[model samples]
Target: MTDLAGRTALVTGGGSGLGAAIATALHAAGADVVVVGRDEAKLDAVAARLGRRARALTCDVSDPASVEELRSRLADTAVSILVNNAGVPGPVAALTDISVEDWDAVFDVNVRGTFLLCRAFLPAMIERGAGDVINVASVSGKRPLAHRTPYCASKMAVIGLTSTLAFEVGPAGVSVNTLSPGPVEGPRMARNFRLEAERSGGSVAEAEAAFVSRAALGRMVTEEEVGRAVVAMLDMPGLCGADVDLSAGMIA
Candidate 1:
């Protein structure tokens, strides 16, 4: 197991789903964790479940004022690990049918939020000459998903940002990488399947089957699998500038 004892980790969107799983895993590895999200109840639930090693903070990542407020709140805390996991699925539609508002909303959370958090926390890591940064991207970022232009584009931006930041901070002994999971089995994936079904005039089951067919494993990845990947990333050394694929060969 990766020994993260005495370290403090920050995971955004840690209220539920993959975020909560990652936070729990980090806490299990002996790290004090801060779970940040916009939903107070969800965040509180996660924090409570994580016991004394975890705490919750509410922040709207897309808003500068809110991010600044979060930075102020963490002024005295040292964050050794940062996970930029907050994201939206965005509208499933043809490019021509997608609205500017929908596209911007996806980018605001997936891309801008990651950028803002990195901006807020990276300097401290650099100053300490040690840290890990994981940006939760998607296989859609590497490959393309039809009718998911906004989400795919935003995640692609995340991969690009992660790669660039890795190079920029590697000299300071901080590792930066992207974790790209494919069609994770969860409410988010179910919702995406539903949206695709509506867009294609197909049944939700067919949409889900189509997604599963894209994976060599013929199934969506589990949340615990993602949590294990996060822990592996934290454990590995000299793993900078890598886009770690937890996509069940979907990218291949």
Candidate 2:
């Protein structure tokens, strides 16, 4: 068993979906969990569900001022674990049809936000001599999806960031790894597909089926599955700097 007792973890986007799962998993493993998101009510609800081990904070990962405030709230306590799980799936559109604003919005949260949060928390980890930084990327990072150009580009950037950060921080005892989840079935996924279905004049079920059929697994992946993978990574020793794919049989 990977013991994480007494460790302090900060998970961005913890108010919903995979972020919530990661936060819950970390808390269940005895870590002091801090859940961060833009929704204070949602964050509080998640924290309440997580019991005494979890703390909720509202922070917009894309905002530097909010992040600076978050750092101030943490004071001098060293954060042993940081999970950059906050990301926007981006508006679905053809590459040529994508608006500049949409592209910037996607990159701002997925790339710039991830970079800033790491910058804020990493120095303390370096000073402490050990830490875990889990960046929740996607299989889209490795393979592109049509009409998801901006999201693909942002995730690819995340993979690049993960690899580079891992190389730079491994020497300082900070293990940075990326987890790429497949078609995780949840509210967020449903919302994304719903929007696409509306745009394309198709049923949500059709959109979902299309997504599942694209995966070699022949089904939509579950939140629990992704959660387990994340918990597994956090528990592994000598598991730094790896892009572990949880895409079922998608690669083959």
Candidate 3:
């Protein structure tokens, strides 16, 4: 891993789960980290664990004004790393059964939020001629995941956004990439498994097995592994315009 001794990182959705894990990894790599999320208590909890090198900031990534406020708050800080991990899992139902509002909400957070953050932060990096951005998408975007059309579509937009933005910004020295993980065993997946079981009339274990069986590894990746992969991606200077899959051979 690269020794990010002088870098500063800002992570969205860095309160719990994968976001928290990524922030922890970046902190361990010697980067001063700012954990951003809607929950002050949760963000504070994460920052507290990282000691003086970390701080919490509150923001709604989907709201433009919220992002602007966050940018103003961080005017004095130089964030060299931006992790756009804030997302929402949309409704688990057939396309015809899904409501328009439900579909819009998913795109608002997953796609719009990523776009807003990048729009807010990328300029400073461009001016400085150095930065890294990892938009946390999912393998579902690249492949197929039944009953999650909104999520898959939104993530696919993020991937496309990253790829195009990378080419536009690489000449200016900033690197933009997407990190797509497969099934990471966590509260999120647990909830998803329960939902799948209810929909399929199967046990939760069976639902989980059905999903894991698709992966060549026959297992799920951990949040910690995803975090480590983020660090590894940062270490590679030439990795611009790429969507790196840490999917346990699920997409391989």
Write down the TM-score of every candidate.
0.98, 0.95, 0.99
Ranking by TM-score: 3, 1, 2
Q: Each model's C-alpha lDDT?
A: 0.93, 0.88, 0.95
Query: Per-residue lDDT tens digits of candidate 3, residues 108-218?
Result: 999999999999999999999999999999999989888999999999999999999999999999999999999999999999999999999999999999899989999
- The full ranking of all candidates by lDDT, starting with the best, is 3, 1, 2
Roughly what TM-score does model 1 have, to 2 decimal places?
0.98
Selected candidate, larger lDDT, 1 vs 2: 1
Candidate with maximal lDDT? 3
lDDT of 1 by residue, 1-252 (tens): 888999999999999999999999999989999999999999999999889989999999999999999999999999989999999999888999999999999999999999999999999999999999999999998786888888998999999999999999999999999999988889998898888888789999999998899889888899988988998999998799999999888888
Clashes of 1: 0
Which should have the higher TM-score, number 1 or number 2? 1
Off by over 4 Å in 2: none
10 residues in a row with least lDDT, candidate 2 = 243-252
